[model samples]
Target: MNPPPINVQPLDTGTTFRSQAYHALKQAISQMDIYDHNDEIRLEERQLSELLGVSRTPIREALTLLEQEGFIRLQPRRGIFVIRKTKAEIVEMIQVWAALESMAGRMVATQATDEDIRTLWDLFRNFEMRNPKEHVNEYSDANIAFHKSIIRLSGSKLIQEMTDNLFIHIRAIRKLTIGQDNRAERSINDHKEIIKALERRDVDQAEHLIRDHTLGLAAHVEKHCDFLE
Candidate 1:
């Protein structure tokens, strides 16, 4: 069976149409479960054009940009499909992300306000009194949010920009694996430790815990996720 059609909003007239359409399409793709075991999902230009309330001309232009960014591929006669990275690529990307996030944690230890730390805690407050394993889906969303909030708390625009693309893959993978191997149960604990380190403003400890937590995901994908092979 075919996966659902790409979701997009009509382009805002105030912005340049092609750029607006490009962002719209990319956002939709990022939210898709491209790693799903189903057949590769295709992107139809006509459908996209109609959905975005634009002509084929701008849709074509927007697609070309997405293609160039390594987000999608266009085959001569086959169709456009989202690009799914191989296991090696996924592991390498996770490794890079681990480095970026660890540094972000260091910055957060030194720069984030007490309220920022509390806000991070708020993400998991409900789970604090319950078992995360019982609510894997909700915790997965909060897990992704927790990492993003840490980056934002770092107060480094460069780090935020660097991890933006990595997140496209990381979020998807985390959602898929969070329920496996009792991972969600372990993840909640790891997050609590990292947050505690940050709260104490322990830079070295925060960096080490954050790096270990992220690198642990890389190791999990490397050993487990055989589908990526």
Candidate 2:
């Protein structure tokens, strides 16, 4: 199959090309469905150079940075490919995310204003009685957005930055798994409960609910899914 398109804009002349290329490539990789079994995604230097209107040198430097950050793999013979975490690796990521996001939830409960908490209600307002099975893709996006909102609402720059790489995996996993079994329906209910806890400013309950919600995916992957197999 053809490699995925390098979705980058032409670089501005002011900033260094290597830095711009790194961020652009990282963002593009993060947005891709890198786990699709049928699509063996690869990155090409010439293609990225053309897309970014720069030479291959900066692209190479940028790719090396991304490789070090665990976003892509620099293979000797097979070419550059996006990194897909193994099952155990993904579970570990979810555990780490659970810890960070749960603390974010605690902060949000204690610090976010009523208006800030109310914003979460909008994410799933339209999906109230609808069948998530029929709209799994859309709901999956909303679900991911809701979790991101939690991190943002926490008002912790460190937490947000820490989860940056984690989202590259977490977003993919959530999208892939949300429609499985009866997880989508249960997910909605869980979100409602979490929101209520946040609204009531119940720090412990909010933290517990958020942590358990994230950790549940780790457990599911451990016992149920063949995602990494």
Candidate 3:
């Protein structure tokens, strides 16, 4: 199925304000800037509004959206707090991600244009060449771009949206993985193989490569990372 065209609009004043506020709040929450000293940290709207230089309305709106996505929780009078993932929850999310990515790769193998393949190959090459010591952020950004490009090529808006939402929850775990020695190198190699499979229009190979690569990353997190504990 083809994705509906994305409508890009000129930024109006209200759209700009809400977008700025959403980004500011999202960064703070994702980066763990807000903390609660009593057991778990709750997101305080007043503090966020003051810190982000926005009003409570937009802050509340953003919190509501995040809460709906399972990124955060809102307790009646207790405040909003980030939802920490359990080991089982993390594993389940990883399984779902693997399935989605494999499906995406299969679709891309059949549907991707030459331009799509070229752009993805360039991004993968750039990711491979990044020096971990000096360009970790660049490498991470490129890695995300490459995967997002594949998802775009799948031509499914609903799947793309769900995959993006999962990424939001997995972003912290991914940061932890990025710090490991040889992890980035292995990831680049896996991406290269997947790109080759796509280039050949080998749907079976592409699906297998994508699923295995994602499951390998999940295994690393389950074995070496304490995020689930």
Candidate 4:
């Protein structure tokens, strides 16, 4: 099926053309079904220009940023391709993600307000409603939400910014891991325990649980790297 065309808005206030272009392209990648299994999805500069309603200049700039951030590859004599990491690289990145998220959990344990906790509980409720075994996409969304909620609650802007960058790079690995054998169920249970720890405001427990849960993806990806296929 042809992906629906994206309607790019005028640059948001206080943002540069490159920034808006980057955000628009990122949204298109995540929101559209543009990939084919076993084959790299190639995007043309003109197609992106037409879809985003921007000139090729900003498109080139945006693609450059995406390339630098490990999202898309600009191949010479080829085309822009979504980049997938090797199994070992994915495992290493997940470990790095775990360390950052664990620190976020520790910070959020003390900094999160009652409203923040309530929002997290809502995400848990959404996860509970989905059949993890069959609804991998839904489960993945919930899983991302549960962890990202902690990062959002952390008061350190630097931590938030760093994790946001890391999150985008490893999002594919995370989605793939969620599709592994019984992985969604395991992730749901881990979220439950982490939530409980957060509810009790146990900083140590929350940090430890979050770290273990995040690292758990590394194990899953190591065992089932082919899940990405």
Candidate 5:
């Protein structure tokens, strides 16, 4: 039996080759083509390089990053396979992220200065202004940044490290989930409420809102997206 075909756009040479290759492939996995009918995806370095019209070096670099982020597993001389999480694992990850972000939100409320809150509102504007129909992908990146900013304000090296570690895995799942109906708009609203809660210096409210945002994401993804196993 033949393997499925993949269609990837040529890399934009304007960017660093590695970044170009990475984003191009990531976008393909996000939308265009990669997965098979069996809900799995596989590719070799040679196949990816040929598909993206780049050198093997950039293809290898992108695959390494993807593998690190838990999107793909590269078995030596076999091929790269997509590593889809189960619904149970997805719920667990989101629960942890909710706990982490809720802690970060509370810390931000208690510890973040007026200027810090001001910076958050300023960052919030980035998402506020986004046209989700035209810019969901960009909005997703901003949403990640918005959550990270609050976590950064926590001023604990440990919290920062944990959130950073969780983000790579979470991001891959988010890529699939964000395109769901009104997901971008809904996420923006949730962030708006969360920021307002933080700015009011309501610790409990901030924690609740942030957890709701993260867990809401879990529920949304569970309902709408398929976790390729």
Candidate 6:
């Protein structure tokens, strides 16, 4: 039997064509609109290209950049795949994230300007003030913003880059686990404790709080793997 015909189409004409394709693909992957067999998950370049009415060239380029950033993986002859994390992997990453974040927290406690401290406090207060009826997405967004604030205060570009890469995977896992209200509440409390320690300029306490908080989250997530899947 002969193979099916390939459906080739012309590329979109305009400047910013690649940028449009890149943003569309990034948004789709970030929003979990893509998935995989075993019902796992992934973002396919060809599908994205088709959806965005663009050529595969720009789609492939965007995928390549995302892969380099550790958000996706490319398998030889297979296709592009979203980087999925297992329970064990999430646990391990939580430990690393805790260490990195704690280090940032410690630095911020010692070196942060008054303005930095005020910004962080504002973010924390905003998180605390969120209405219970609001969607988990709101809380998740705030959570990311809070961490980004800490990273901004850390003054280490390398640390920021590494943590940003790790958090992409962490954020995906958090999306899986966000349905657990207990976990969400616990995470909020954890952030509070870390902030309190920072407020005191207690580096040791800040580090300990951050690590223990993350370990607690890992434990909570492990006990509720059903929510993760």
Report the number of the highest-lDDT candidate. 2
Q: Write the residue-wise lDDT of candidate 5 on 30-54 in tens digits.
A: 4422322445567777878877778
TM-score of structure candidate 4:
0.85
Q: Quote model 2's TM-score.
A: 0.94
In Å, residue 50's CA in model 2 sits off its true spot by 0.9
Q: What stretches of model 1 exceed 4 Å from their correct place?
A: none
lDDT of 4 by residue, 1-229 (tens): 4533444555554657677889888766654333224555677889777766667898899999989877789989988886755667768888988998899998888888867776777776765666786888887777777777787888878877777666754665676567778888888888888878887899999999999988878887777665454
Candidates arranged by TM-score, highest first: 1, 2, 4, 3, 6, 5
Using lDDT as the yardstick, the better of models 2 and 3 is 2
State the weakest 10-residue window (summed lDDT) of model 5: 30-39
Which one wins by lDDT: 2 or 4? 2
Residue 142 miss distance in model 4 (angstroms): 1.0
Ranking by lDDT: 2, 1, 4, 5, 3, 6
Q: In candidate 3, which residue ranges exceed 4 Å CA deviation?
A: 1-42, 51-54, 127-135
Which residue pairs in model 6 clash with each other?
36-41
lDDT of 3 at 136: 63
Q: At residue 208, give the lDDT of candidate 2.
A: 99
Model 2: per-residue Cα lDDT over 41-152, one tens digit each? 7887888999999999999999999989889889898899888888889999999999999999999999999999999999998797787778999999999999999999
lDDT of 3 by residue, 1-229 (tens): 2211212222234565566666555555555412112246556677666666666887687777777777789999777767777766776788898899899999999988867877777775554455553566667667667777888899999888888777755665665566476777777778889999999999999999999988887888778756466
The models' CA-based lDDT, in order, is: 0.89, 0.90, 0.71, 0.75, 0.75, 0.68
Each prediction's TM-score versus the true structure: 0.96, 0.94, 0.78, 0.85, 0.66, 0.73
> What is the Cα-based lDDT of residue 75 in candidate 4?
88
Cα error, candidate 2, residue 205 (Å): 0.1
Number of the predicted model whose TM-score against the real structure is largest? 1
What is the C-alpha local distance difference test score of candidate 1?
0.89
- Encode model 6's per-residue lDDT on 136-175: one tens digit a residue: 6777677667777877788988888788667656666665
